[model samples]
Target: MEGNEMKAFMKRVDYLLVGILLFSLGLNFYHLNNAGTNTYYTAAVKSMMQNSHAFFYASFDPEGFITVDKPPVALWIQTLSAKIFGLSDFSVLLPEALAGVISVFLMYILVKPNFSRTAGLLSSLVLACSPIFVAVVRTNNVDSILILTLLIAAWAVMKAVDQKKLGWLILSVTLIGVGFNIKMLQAYMVVPAIFLFYWMAVKLTWKKRLLHLIAATVVMAGISLSWAVAVDSVPASERPYIGSSQTNSVLELAFGYNGIQRLLGQNKGTKSMGSASTAVQNKDNSSTTNTSNGQTPSNQSAAASGQAQGTTSSSNNQGAAVTDSSSSSNTQAPMGNGAPPNFQGGMGGKMGGGTGGMFGTGTAGPLRLFSSELSGQISWLLPFILFAVIGLFAEFRKTKKFDMRIKFAAFWLTWLIPMMIFFSMAQFFHQYYLSMMGPAIAALVGIGWTMLWNYFTTNDGWKSGLLPCGILTTFLFEALILNQNSQSKFLVVGTVLVGVILFILMVQRMKKETYSPALPMAALLALLILPLYWTGITINKTNNASTPIAGPGSGMGGMGGMGGMGGGARMAANMGFPGGAGNIAPEGAQDTSGNSASGSQTQDGSMTPPTNQDSASIPASAPANAGKTMDNRNQLNTALLSYLEKNYDGEKYFLATDSTQTAAPYILNTDYSVMAMGGFSGSDPALTPTKLEKMAKAGYVKFFLISGRGGMGGNQSESVTQWIKDNCEEVPSSEWQSATSSQIQTSFGRFGGETLYVYKD
Candidate 1:
């Protein structure tokens, strides 16, 4: 690479765009070699890379006993990357990091044609610097990839409008179907926007538009269901059990577990775990009662003990109460469905018990997304959105034909509004899922700023003030969020000072009748400072192993990113908030293990669920000084791996455990198959006594780690657990694990505490 070649490359390079993308690449791949991967999903990647069936099903382990909760498309990308690059933290996370960068670029290209290049850059830059967006991009979770797919679909929609080609429209919706496979129903968040834009912008006849729209929907549905239909059609015996489904059916999963349950905030499906037969769809608008300052009662520390166990099922309820240790009580509604906040199959949500709403999203209302619990993640530029939306349609009367700006604005609004409503009212959702609202926010802010500025310098009207108002209002909002989080006063002061100074400068320039772009550019940079720094702090840890939030102390991993970075997750817990997993059992239900799994008590004295999401596993790379954090948590033990590998009996599975959490470490650490008998949460009813007997007789599993609560499922799962205890021989932990590490893996919660019991014939 001589200077001449470099010079030639530089000349062809779109440096401004490349520079923004490079910064995004930096954020997404900054510590690629060192950062922790989400252990839960990463295990699936490891397993999916093992064989064709595992690959097709996104198996959580090599044995193909069960699939990961989400569809296989995103994991397919990661598995391919891991295969080509050789599995490692960096290799598995590359697709998402790259997707993050490419999505930034897509934002630019998507905006530039309809507006100015600067508008595109502004949109791209906002997205690139977004803390939550960067956080998700840096993880192995499917959200970023899902976002990338949706953005590509957006580009296709643009093509259909620009060219009036029905083929392009079809391609657009088809890509959306691909997105559905990446993230289940989340991909549909943008579908309405797409259809609205196409119908309003395309010049086709009304009948043609109707017919074309119907065809597009058909294509979208077909593509969306392609994998699900194929997987579901296969005999239950031929494929892995669907991870989150109650009935072992993909459609049920799509419409239920990953679908409505997300909105309902309950892991409802079975009558086994509680008295209710379905997920509690009845919304309890009563606030989750907790201690003042919004910390969970009895949770007095956020310091890292550095333990890393995955979310546990609520322990067998015995109706017991103890002093000095009980999860905070919810007065009315209980969001727990006997699983952790990290949704079944380890899809994590808001990890901490900070109350805004049921899941720390603030009480459901129009102001919900604006609440402190939610705003810090995605609302820095929200004030600008209103003015932008109104201004976007301002030029509609200037021409009889529909404007591209108007069309795009309508599409973006459609996308943002539905998502806003969902995030505001929906009970069950992770903060990172808010990334869906980001592109629209960025696009509108960019274009709206452009519109406002054009009017500010050239017109003498009320619209001219919107820019300064938007900037100042955003400044106030950022300050409020900072103040609420108790963030650095320096950052808050910086936001206000920077915003006020920019507003003044823009106002001065407006008076002077000069339209130089410097003020707007400076304003954009001013807005980016805080989210950028927040993104920086989040670069080291996986945030929460499952939830993957950004910002200072945003390391609560309900799905157990806590599983990967035990130290950070502990530090987050030490931040003095806890919520995520717990369950209340039926009265008189006998506890086989003799433990109680209950949450806070309500006014009527009935119990709510627990919300503690600290991890028991930490990356081996974590700072060694985090202390003896691995005791009784789910830390991956090399010695255990060596023992299982060395004691091979030509069995199909190296080990079988209660659920994926117990098996994820072994699957990710080694090539051997590890079976999670009850699937993701040990509640899927995936195995039966007959199946276990056949596997045992066939020598398919030589060992069973009966160390945790069997599951939150029915008689089938419990019966299988009993059969194992009765039929198999329990090996002493001293023979394999370190003497001090015998109880080295708490399954999901304290009620489901770790107790090492290895059973084998």
Candidate 2:
């Protein structure tokens, strides 16, 4: 413990941290350009880079017809990145990737002061390997940036608590307000946790604490609403229509479309994400209480002996399947509807009736996070988190006063528990949103493992049982998740074996009145192997940029082999992802819902299940932009791009389409302003016949990418279609579309076909 030795130890830790950050950088940046980009966001970034006006609004087109659905903070970062790196997929996604890397380092910084260096290091490592975290950051999604901002706030709060600085506390809340601009109410998800931790741990008079909090709250509200209020203050005639808002107001967009509607899964124009009760099951709704591997959740203690019954998986070296008897079936249930009635109104997700239920987040229930649809994305270490919480409570029970340990436990658990509740019950969310859980889970794992070892070597046999129990239980849970969802279900055995061997050694050493932390450290390393492999899958295979999810077969971008629209669509599907075997479900495809992965001709529109013997493709059959009601096929018609460019007459808008799905490819590929009439889901009532007629007459636009209400699902109005048909001339397919061009469905599934028209007075 002398200064020189301590300095050497610190040096080693720094080297290791640098190495881990390097690895994180590689994971975030590797194959990044080839990976699918959420063209919806990428197109917006393209337009945001055009000029200051579009940049400020996070406009989807250079003309600033409407803004992106969320606030502009994250997009603003992306815009600056594009400015520095130039407009390209890599530039657009660079901020997200860097954010992810910084968040990993922040995890270490946030944990090390309260916990130990060991806990901090382990936390960073765990976050770096988190599948969903890696998956989303690899895309153009805002979540990485959101998480990055939140983690910085967490660091500031730690400083606030540690240094007793009122200014630091204010700074923390101010940063949280900044996060609100990045993702709106999602930033508030962690607010309760932060405030509770502050009040409980700050050691001040309750009244002063309340006053300080009130002050912080005021600052947070001001910062959070700064842009929204500014934008709303502008006259409707001067500013673009607020995208995704029922009324052209920023506050409405915040409190409505991006707020409560998220909970109800009903925005305003799309399908009602019916609640959990409406889970669409196959013909067989009867439950038989079956575990795939014939093992029960409670019996996983055998994993301590490396003979955890079903821990032996032989299928493709996939990880082991944990058998939970509480679950009704071993089969991974495809996502079912999980929103309230009347909540319909997204870009494409059926408020009801489709298998891509509620953004493929799985049926809403207490166990939704463990559902196969989500487990691969974020639940790899979930059991560890649960056990960690229990261990902390038990170990710290005697500490009545709030110490740093208790304070941190409160911070991590508060941050973790509410998000668990939200994701478990809320209807509208993507899997990547689970990245918010990564830091808490990662930090808890490190702290919990440290505590687990401490109790294990205590010589109090009763108190020491947690280590074996934790290992066995986590192995069982992980095994089940892999069996039900992962292609690599056989990976469970090695980690279980290693943990079992270490447990045996620890017991023998305890008998001899000796202890070694190395045994526990080795065991923790073993547990991280599988998640690392999953991250690798995200780096190389996944290209479903719009709804970035990780794990085996996750890159189902072109839902029905509907190809990309242009070279940029390659950012979504055409990168040889497995799901695009074609419009036909590749011979043995099973829908994530247990239904056929692709839609079939059924009168009731109740997606039909596949035959029992059907094999698995990427797990979710309905997840890729089902929110927008479009099968996620980009099919950027280069010929169409050429056609429009060749006939360009210096118009303000090159092409106008019902929703972003149609306009995104053209916008990403060209500098031309392509107006997405209804915005993202094509459901926003941003424009009317009057607006369209004026724009057409003003020579602001010329060509219209017309589709029926079913084609692309956004604000495709009857009046708009009728007005276009009455006023414009239809362009023949031969003039632009190629003979061999397999038209990626520009419409929302089988509902409509897309046609081109010239807007002539």
Candidate 3:
């Protein structure tokens, strides 16, 4: 390559990256416009930008009560972008979109040495335009940062291998550390892949290998530990709440909850693994009891433990304690009594024990069937696995002449395999978490594609190459068409017809003189881009036209649906809160008709069900209680509210509710402080009166509002309600009236038959 050629190549790369950047920008703008900031991460960013003038970092709550859950690296970039561009939805998401584009460029650069430029371009294009990648990039999430970090780390490691440079090794380790800082523990998963690459490339003696490992570990430790040390130096009061730990330090939260708890599920802070285990056991016991004797085992023991302390029953109930009681009527001997069995020693053993040793048992057939449903979720890993297999085959076939890139790919596979196995064994798995492997997957796929192309051309197999290329071109074209249809069916059909014509023209050229694979791939890329363009336009219009709907059922008028009752789905409506299509009453509003609205049925239906105005939405709010009648239910509510106000400082106190907006105005508008109650739902036996007492003791929550009639339909456990009645004093009607007057409440007027009970510790 001459100097001018190299310059031209670089210029082309720059042009490609810039084009991707603009494309990503348009997509993100559309998504933000359509969804108006979809996930919690985006909401957090928007909140920060709205409240704090600085963008580098913004607290989730205005009081700086909770810092953003994710690390500040991405947020800092986003904040700076917003500052320069002027904070709009687009500005807030610009950092992720840009990072996404840079990742594509990095992919091209990283793979260019191992594969042809065409292969590199195709891989980059696949990543840039893939629905999954584009979706992550368009949203304000940490996944994009994860992708960038992984790519940079992979590139650095490859550089080290190519140059035999310790500096590159250190740099790669440092980048891994940075990834950990962004998302705790996820970066470390790449180590196995990198180490495997090294071992395959240059086999070192055990002693040298040990030394290298130590050096790499030290570098990684330095990168990760620096943040911990800085965070630990801060005072306890300054730290966010980790579990129940006295120190709210960022380090404690990161290390204890995000880092350790995520892997081991042993965080002692808020919700401990022990408690979760115990809850599972209790649930099992109740189900068994119900089946055997038509009586549910009392969850009094679990209930008494409260929020601060989690309980794990002893292993006595293991055998008899069915993991899923719904499966079979046949009773097995009790494995143990208290805690669930800890079978982390062996993956198969753990899985078997957790599922009641059902793997081979024909009786446990239903459980196997249930597990099969998750196959689709794990399918994303297939592309990477396929690439790894191809790379391994390529490396072994060329053993006489070593390809450093192949060796590097081998190392990545080594790292990826162990991490995949570990995650698979570990009980918790989600597809998004696999995103860390996206770069490696892209690299492998690029290599595999190149290998196939070379094989055909070397064999004078132009006709064979035509078939595979044609197939790939068709697949890419169809994907584009389907994606485009998401915007407008007519537009996509027209585009597909035009693409068919272009494909025919390309085929003609191929027949004359084997046209470069790049030409067809480029055309396919254009087809894909078309849909995203229209998608961007749709999102922009949606954003511009959106109107804030009142939280569900407050009659603040907005879209309505069954899924609108819960905060998550309901907030998706214009108002960004509950009470849209399905939600009947707003957050605090209750149905006075004594007809318990089936909240359990709603929850069981779907997390985000489509809006069914007739069947889903709560038809009307409960009629107002006219006379100031003090009944047992009203007394219980009043006593709870009165006790909370009298014992706790009303100004500093907040009602513990799931709805933040509804709760916020009532608590914040009035001198009283409020925050959303974060915990398992009321149905969980884990929530006890003692837990409420502990929450009050820790100043986490001051009051608990108990609606007399169930609107959403799920009721508080009998044990929880009884405990509250026995231990805490309810607010008096007179005090409730006074507090109501003091608080500039939003949903209070709409509370049909709902009773607000405030209680003190």
Candidate 4:
């Protein structure tokens, strides 16, 4: 290409990138309030930035001691924006929105060199406008960061392959390492897929491949290990123990139980338990079978044991399993409890369970099984099928000689295979975990669409072209009809108008004397972007519904709904309360188990526990400093602080009935802490005994607040309500605590919520 032509091409690409960025910004900006807003990660990041003044020094709850889980990279970007722009919802989210736009630009640049300019443009546009991509990036989440890193890594790997540049290889490894810091071992999954693809491409001897593999391994290890070392250096008490570290806690919970455990319809550690029980059940069945056949049961046992050992030996041969005993040991706890156990011979349980007459009985909990099925349907498996089929054809045709097929194949594998293997072998799987694949899927669709368009227009001729045109025309017509019928609906009308315009352009192209293939594609790209943008706008507008507002009859600064206290009570009950209501010592509380006494029913129908029975109810006398009105700020702050000082010291009940309203107060108030156990319902004195007993044993309580108007009854699930009934304690006398109005204003205006409960163990 000539210098002027190259310059023009670059200019076009730049213009297109800017346009996409603006569209992305607008889409994300408008949809800030969507129900499916970013998850806990966004909240965590925002909290970190608010606490820490600097970008690199991210902290959450400066008064408290919780470090941010994600790496500094993304947080650093957000922190800078917050500091410079002034902290607000928009400021915190701008970094992700901008990164998302940049990632799209990078995707275009990476594809443009290998594919036609039209293909590059279409691919980038498709990714920019993908429903999932737009939704994920617009919200506050680590997904945008993951997408950015994956794109950079792909670009780096492509450069290395094309130029044989070791620098690019190192850079790619570094990016993966950084990705690991963002979310632990999740990033490492891409390595195996990338290496396998490379091996297939080069057909190199094992020794040659091993060298590259070792280099990549060392780089990944260095980056990940450094963070691990830092975390390990902290005292165990100070460490963030998000889950347990046992068969149920550490290996099972983190990897299998909480990881893929749900996929098999088991609890966090139930998969391991289920597997072990099945093994024992199989052994018992085998013994019975041999005895029935008039053969020595010992012989069958020995043979089964030998087979188990042999399988273990084979796994050991590949260093996959350390010993057969390992699986047996891990499965023992769950088996004893009659819970489903996960296979523990690394990933070897699949073979063992299959041969040993152990498979899912299909009686696993409906919710968990349904979740697992949905996860499998949406995750890497579906994308792999889509990409492999399209990628194979693209490679075979050799229409574009620029090696776009291999790059995409490599990129897809690198991101996908590792995650699939890890999750499949894990004890649990959740839909959110699959969010990482959104970008990869978007990229694949973009490329696939471009390839299909090219094939029809160039190879299959006019007949093939008519099919896409017809589909486009039909979409346009439907959109036009919807628009005319729903003029007030901005999203629907805007989408239809965009589709019609794009279809008209495509139709015009079909009739032109000489078609510029890019015209139709560009139009189609616009159609995709416009709808997604409109959808995002709608979501943001709808998210406002989540905000908690003050209403009439809401006591004390319009606070009415039970605070998170009620939820905490339910969680305590579910955990198996070790002590009786209020008498049982909490997990972190001082030991008073010996002094603690169980409760008996009172004449008023209250289950008055023996210890602190009188103190359990709110004190009748207000403090000497207490004033009549709660209108002043200082007085309110002092009263709130006093309330916290009195209430926050011991285990307190948390009610999570109103999650959306609850987060702000729980987050803002240091004196207040929450335990998310179950939903909220009106207070029932009759249910207090069992609930209080559970809370005492579990060492916590969640008091559900009931407004006179009847709060959150039919809306809550049976399991959730049952959990609350089983866990929480109700104290009827502890009502209507007085506060200065200033404290009320501070708590209500800054962190909107209705009722508050003091959780006691």
Give candidates' CA RMSD values in order. Answer: 11.9, 14.9, 13.4, 17.5
For candidate 3, write residues 449-565 as lDDT tens digits. 566545433443343343344434443444343442242566556665665676565556545534476754455455445434423333332111111111111111111121112
Best by lDDT: 1
Each prediction's TM-score versus the true structure: 0.80, 0.78, 0.57, 0.53
- If ranked by TM-score, best first, what sequence of candidates would result? 1, 2, 3, 4
- A best-first ranking of the candidates according to their lDDT comes to 1, 2, 3, 4
**363-449 in candidate 4: lDDT tens per residue?**
123232122222211221242234334544555665555354655545664565455444444432222244455555545545555
* Deviation from native of the Cα of residue 209 in model 2, angstroms: 0.6
The superposed Cα distance between candidate 2 and the true structure at residue 595, in angstroms, equals: 31
Q: Which stretches of candidate 4 lie over 4 Å from their true place?
A: 1-13, 31-87, 196-207, 238-240, 243-258, 262-410, 413-435, 459-523, 526-534, 544-642, 645-664, 669-761
Q: Higher-lDDT candidate among 1 and 2?
A: 1
RMSD of 3: 13.4
Question: Considering TM-score, which of the candidate structures 3 and 4 is the better prediction for this target?
Answer: 3
Q: Which candidate, 2 or 3, would have the higher lDDT against the true structure?
A: 2
